[model samples]
Target chain A: MKKRDIILVAAVLILAGGIWLITRVFFNDSGGQLRITVDNEIYGTYDLKQDQEIQIGTTNTCEIKGGKVTMIQADCPDHICMHSAAIDKDGGTIVCMPNRVFLEIVGQEDGGVDTIAQ
Target chain B: MKNKIAFLGLFAALAIILGYVESLLPVFIGIPGIKLGLTNLVIVFILYLYSWKEALLISVVRILAIGFLFGNLYSILFSLAGGVLSLFVMYFMRKIPGFSVLGVSVAGGVTHNIGQLFVAAFVVTNFKLMYYLPVLLVSGVVTGLLIGMVSGEIWKHVGAYIRKNNREKL
Candidate 1:
């Protein structure tokens, strides 16, 4: 309603827009690998180019098909994980909170920097 | 003194009931950590109608009660971070002249999401979680605007009633 209020809203909108642009441009690496972790431990990494099914500790199941990873099923009551969309780009994630399972996409370039410096 | 305590208790209960109602709604948005934050309506109402100290007390007590009733340790941690951070921001913003309730609530909503994101990043040690900022920020603004408008209306009636009662007592 006031000048200050308009400034605050505009600032927030611009910040959000900037973050959206950065994520879209720099973070969306399509050739990313799917990294699955269960109970805070690394379960395994699978190539997004391959099709496979992963079962995590009898609590959740994930499927990688056609270059996308999805939580196919879960034992959690809400099934929020199962409802989450498939992830095929870097920085995307599917989390099963009740099961303590986390799946994320990591671009191949993510670790390349460390390997190159070494 | 007794009346003050009674009103605080009433506000806390109202906040908790609003939280319960929000939890019952199906996730219209599939994204996690996105909610209408209906309970904040009460907190914002208290901020305008009473002192910041009272608003802070009600907010903390409501989050703790909700955590005990329906959440685990993890939920408690995130809610504590979000609720405390937002309350501080809202209180500070309210002190600045020329800022409307809408602006204060908008700041509160956005910061609440940011605070939760910080906790999530710390828990997972993944900074990439920042990628969710855009969605969360937009949702925050929308929900904050809605809550702020509702609270503005409630404040009109409640503020008048409280002023009348205090004047009568004197």
Candidate 2:
């Protein structure tokens, strides 16, 4: 490979690694609640500690078990949300773009309200 | 002139076919934007063979065709964002010295994902979508390298053949 090509590849790797480090250090935390949103509006917040299934607007079904939330079922054609990895303590997201459903792990210290800036 | 136009059409068709092939594959790592970016092979090749104008045209045509045939309106918007941004990046990268098709293609692939992420964030009205940056960047680089390698191989033989044909015609 050319010198510039190697540099280009190395640059991308380093940038990706840096972003990952930042996210792990700053964003990811042992969250207590899973925030579900539809079309940017709050749908509901479920506790990760409790095991339960939630149906969001008849388009998606989410399950919370063992401190992890997963899109157990979806009617979307791609089923991308269904295939996405479960979001847990380390703070991740599952977005079903087709259905406009978004599930995220947020550290809600105050169970009364979502004060987290997100 | 006719030959060049015909080749551009062929390239667009090939890109669409690659897009279809990619659709057949299951989503990788469960990430929305992560894919083989197989169609980029044609885009990179055409960029080197012709100019950004032709490359842009082919890219647009392929995205529109594939988007309508297999995807929905939302998908079309996302694809347009990614495709146009990547094409611009590749066009500029090609002008830099010592950076070959591999480098240009890598730039294209990574920027493509970034562009899509921006649109996704805007659509969802949440910047938290940036959370996927790390994974998307890594996937882009990996797929870009693979596509670039194949493109380089194709350019070696096809580029030479095309140049020879042009000289004979002249």
TM-score of each model, paired residue for residue: 0.71, 0.71
**Highest lDDT against the true fold, candidate:** 2
Clashes of each: 0, 0
lDDT per residue (tens digit) for residues B12-120 in model 2: 9999999999998887666556888999999998888888999899999999999899887767888899999999999999998899888988899999999988987
Candidate 1 lands at a TM-score of: 0.71
For residues A5-115, could you state the per-residue lDDT of candidate 1 as single tens digits?
889888898999999999888876447789999889999988887898988889899999988889998999999999998887545899999989999987643422221
Task: Write candidate 1's Cα lDDT for B1-170 as tens digits.
Answer: 77778878999999999988987877537666788989999999888877778988998899899989977676778888998899999999999888898899899999998888889778767777787798889888888888888887787888778878876441
Clashing pairs in 2: none
Off by over 4 Å in 2: A30-118, B168-170
For residues A2-116, what per-residue lDDT tens digits would candidate 2 score against the true structure? 9999999999999999999998888665356899999999999887878899999999999999888999999999999999988886678999999999998787433221212
| RMSD in order of candidates | 12.1, 12.1
For model 2, what is the alpha-carbon lDDT of residue A25? 85
